[model samples]
Target: MSATGTYNKLVPEPTPHSAPYWEGLNRRKLLLQKCRGCGRIRHYPQPMCPSCHSMEVEWVEASGRGVIHSWTITHHAFHPGVREDLPYTLATVDLEEGVRMLAQLRGVPDDKLRIGLPVRVEFETVKDGLTLPYLVPGEPA
Candidate 1:
């Protein structure tokens, strides 16, 4: 949590459905839920398909690459623990796989953040069972 200069106040509480995602992050891989019924991908994993209302679902590995669709520079921490790490960037990334994810942005200055900025995922091991995915500026192809 502190490794990237961000506060480690919040740790994800993975549910049964979200366990795969957290587990994948531990291995430095990004995993997203894919609805078999509609061939749609989604984050914040859920039990049924949103597009088709089907119960058939599967897990797929994400490329971990995305473009910043939107972003916000937080000047104050809603959580007290992160108060020291003020002015951090949080972004909504549109993944290459067609789903959007909210993750913290690292290695990118506040002034440089913009829509359509390419980003790639990186993992930080916060604890034994917790590994957080962060966004770093993606390299040019």
Candidate 2:
């Protein structure tokens, strides 16, 4: 990995269904899969809709606004690259679009975290021209 954790770092192995979601992040966008048949939005892109078992789906851009549904503060660095950034918050946020996403909650102290705290999406560029999305406390957009 690069000195600043900018290269050769672990990222999701994108499948064909998930490529668009990952690709969206490169442009600082959050893309979710919406099932045409059931109108359900889902993350971790899939070929078929889990709600309706339909193959018809479309990529939709998320509003990037959400509220913390749950979270945990990690005191241990599970990965070497994140050692310097330890004691970070990992959160499950319920997006305004009705999808829940799990991402690192950035710029928020452990003492400040609470359920239903509004958040917005932010991107962190990683290795191989990819970007990872994180959440930061903010007003709903």
Candidate 3:
């Protein structure tokens, strides 16, 4: 959110387990942690798998394709940093890799919003060395 080192928006702080995910986003790729023990993919990276309680983990590139499971339009800003971007859409997307991710939904009008609509991830560089993913209407290529 800060382009000149004065932005006030909160940014993600990567930890040891989540560093790869942040790094992948910087490279414009969406990555998820896959459990080696059970092959279940997960978001919000962690050291252990929730399904199998496995410590074995691997990073895999996600397809970046998903469907809108649900969404809500924010009519008010919860923080001062996002006040200017009022009336934004927050969507819950079910990725093809079997993980659900929540992110800002953009490039679509409110009247056009619907459940089960196709979407894809796109990166936006808010500042140097920092990029984030958001969803937009589209089908996987």
Q: Which numbered prediction scores highest in lDDT against the true structure?
A: 3
The local distance difference test score of each candidate is 0.85, 0.85, 0.89
Q: CA shift at 64, candidate 3, in angstroms?
A: 0.6
User: For residues 8-102, what per-residue lDDT tens digits would candidate 2 score against the true structure?
Assistant: 34568889888989899999999999999999998778799877899888999999999999998888977776786677788999999988999
Task: Name every residue pair that clashes in candidate 3.
Answer: none
Q: Model 1, which residues run further than 4 Å from truth?
A: 3-8
Pick by lDDT: 2 or 3, better one? 3
Q: What is the C-alpha RMSD of each candidate to the true structure, in Å?
A: 2.6, 2.2, 1.7
Report the number of the highest-TM-score candidate. Answer: 3
List TM-scores for all candidates, in order: 0.89, 0.89, 0.92
Residue clash pairs of candidate 1: none
lDDT, ranked from best to worst = 3, 1, 2
lDDT tens digits, residue span 17-66, model 1: 88998899988889999888988888789988877998777889998888
- Candidate 3 TM-score, true structure as reference: 0.92
